[model samples]
Target: MTPSNQRCSVAIIGGGAAGITAAAVLRKRAPQLSVTIVEPSSTHDYQPAWTLVGAGEYDVATTRRRLKAVLPAGVSLIQQRAHSFEPTSNRVQLEDGSILEYEQLIVAAGLQTNWQLIDGLVDTLGKNGVCSNYSYDTAPYTWECVQGMQNGRALFTQPPMPIKCPGAPQKILYMAADHFKRKGRKVELGFCNAGPAIFGVPFYAKALMQVVKHYGIATHFGYNLVAVNGPGKEAVFETTVDGMKIRHIEKFDMLHVTPPQSAPDFIKNSPLADAAGFVAVNKHSLQSTLFPNVFALGDCAGTANSKTAAAVRAQAPIMVSNLLALRMGSALSAQYDGYASCPLTTSVGKIILAEFGYDGVVMPSFAADPRKPARRYWHLKKRFLPWLYWNQMLMGNTGPDWHAKREYPDTLPSISP
Candidate 1:
């Protein structure tokens, strides 16, 4: 078969946290190797701040930056969406019909937000008091809706499983409640969660329960939002019980909706994906099952971990190592034992830093007590994490041992292993 162009040492298929981080680590470790990033977006988002913005902590200007500024200089940056992958030739087909070849491929394209999954959710997001922190445009609307309403039913709905920052849906809820409490206008706060429990992790869930009671938030488990009548200010939810239920109408003064999410369409339809549409990779190494040259990181990888950017910080180094190893024609040894994290922002001053790996409770960073909510955790999330994410992680100036060393468990192996 004839090829279209010269094959690259590595073609990273994304410019977000995972992809860029991998590129930075690769260049730092092996400067001689050439890297090209194929990304569609010119602007990158610091999504962790979106929750803070929805809570009136930050404005839109603070959450975004030019992608060119963040990416490592001199690397070939192809600003295009990867439309399809040809693992046989180690090539990716861009949306513009251009093809890129890579000795190694890192699919850190991340998850897709499915606002269209819910009927009428997209049509009336910015208007009709429908707001979500998932988007930059809708985040301020959340604050706007929160501000305008004094004392009426304010419904916050968590769509379905596996959205980024699973705790984020409720985090905004608590902050909004805290806002009303401060103003002496504690409106009706209802948490319509799709999950069966308050939170997947129990340790933090216990702390969450205390806060829920403190703020007097009505927690409804197993209730999923099915439809939104935004013009009428009404939301329809379906109950997970045996009822095969229809919509239960609930009028709202303000509605904050976290939409359901899934893997990107291309990955889901490709052989690279699992049943859930996530890229099927070794849970430890993040290399694809079908192709050794192919790897995935971040939310798109099918690992048994909470999909969080904090986890991406840890996985980026592992992916880089394994990708480099594959390029050197060696067996991978680095493993990423599903180390995902979520910063459960209980309030403006408090946070439960939920850092755990697979098989429940793997927090080597939190040597002290990972269970209890600490002011230190709050400080780290509110003050330090953003700095660490931007100045360190994105800029490739992170902790010295971030991707170079393993600190979690002695018995476990690296994800690339």
Candidate 2:
């Protein structure tokens, strides 16, 4: 059915974490506002739990819910893909050629996973021991590959940066390593990362290096997975040294790939996008640089913060507050400090919760040493976070402001050279 040319006070471009949370907040704080979300999918996913799903620790079924069930009351739902944005005219063109007009727009369409970028990946994914935790369907196959492996090489590949949850590629690796250790499986593990470090934050990267050392996992830096010959169980990686590109092929019994990601096609081609193709918004205000009536958050926002649910949690309230202020003709007081958290699963029962703000400043909520892995954090990741996401965040509760002002020791120990 073609969508009617209905105008809304606020129109969200995606029904993912950012869009839903923002709509929920607007419904609670400003119930008079007519909010509409344009999303193609019928189900909303709690994507953070997919890491555990791939580790065989969490049920994949629990991570998803029907989109209509989770949406806040009185908000309109447009179950269609956004084809293009006409920012100058304050209108969005849907895939069905229907136009949606909004006084204010929120671009939270999230990033796109380019699976076909890797040669033969689409043909062999979920079979021939080629799997990935990136998709809900493929995630379960990763666990299957891990469980079936007795020996030989197990390889995990991480694409270049800006992918949602950068720590995800290695999180499964650690879980698989811990699983093998418990089951007395002698699988040789290797991590192939296109980036130069295990993590973006130096403080956590140092700690993660120790975890990699503990697992006896081979670390291949600067190696980018370019092709996957799944039938032959061989993976190809390209790298550059001395300005010359080189391709390296390695045989593997099992391979987990994290595909390259970018903003959705409609977003990339829109005038609101930056040079990097993400929604061009202020790093702090989240207001579109070109259009003040527009805002963005989550993976689609052109911010330096790590793309995670935690970032969306922080960004939603700030964006909502600022948007409301703009509507009220008041100064935009709420500012997002780029706070994002990454709970790195180093083992089955331990997690190194890496929390940071702009410019990689350590921002720990708890007083405990933020660098150490702990069992409590594991429980938080496995249990509390999911509950908070479904009940609190989606329910329009932002909780307390504990992360912004929490202080940490200045003289914390550093990694030795």
**Highest TM-score against the true fold, candidate:** 2
Indicate which candidate wins on lDDT. 2
lDDT per model, in order?
Answer: 0.81, 0.91
Off by over 4 Å in 1: 1-6, 362-364, 400-417
Task: Tell me the lDDT of candidate 1.
Answer: 0.81
**Tens-digit lDDT track for model 2 on 66-157?**
99988999999999999999989999999889999999999999999999999989999999999999999989998999899988899999
Query: Where is model 1 poorest over a 10-residue stretch in terms of lDDT?
Result: 408-417
- The deviation in Å at residue 310 for candidate 2 is 0.5
Q: How do the residues 1-417 of candidate 1 rate in per-residue lDDT, one tens digit apiece?
A: 543454688898889888888888888888898899999999999998899888888877878999998998667898889899888888888887778888888888888998898899889998888899998888988888888878989988887778887889988988888788878895999999988878886655666777788788898888899889888988988885576775688888888999999999999988788899988899998899888888999888888788888788888888888888887888889988776678777777666666677765546464544445566876777678888888889866546432221233233221110
* lDDT, residue 14, candidate 1: 87
TM-scores for the candidates: 0.92, 0.97
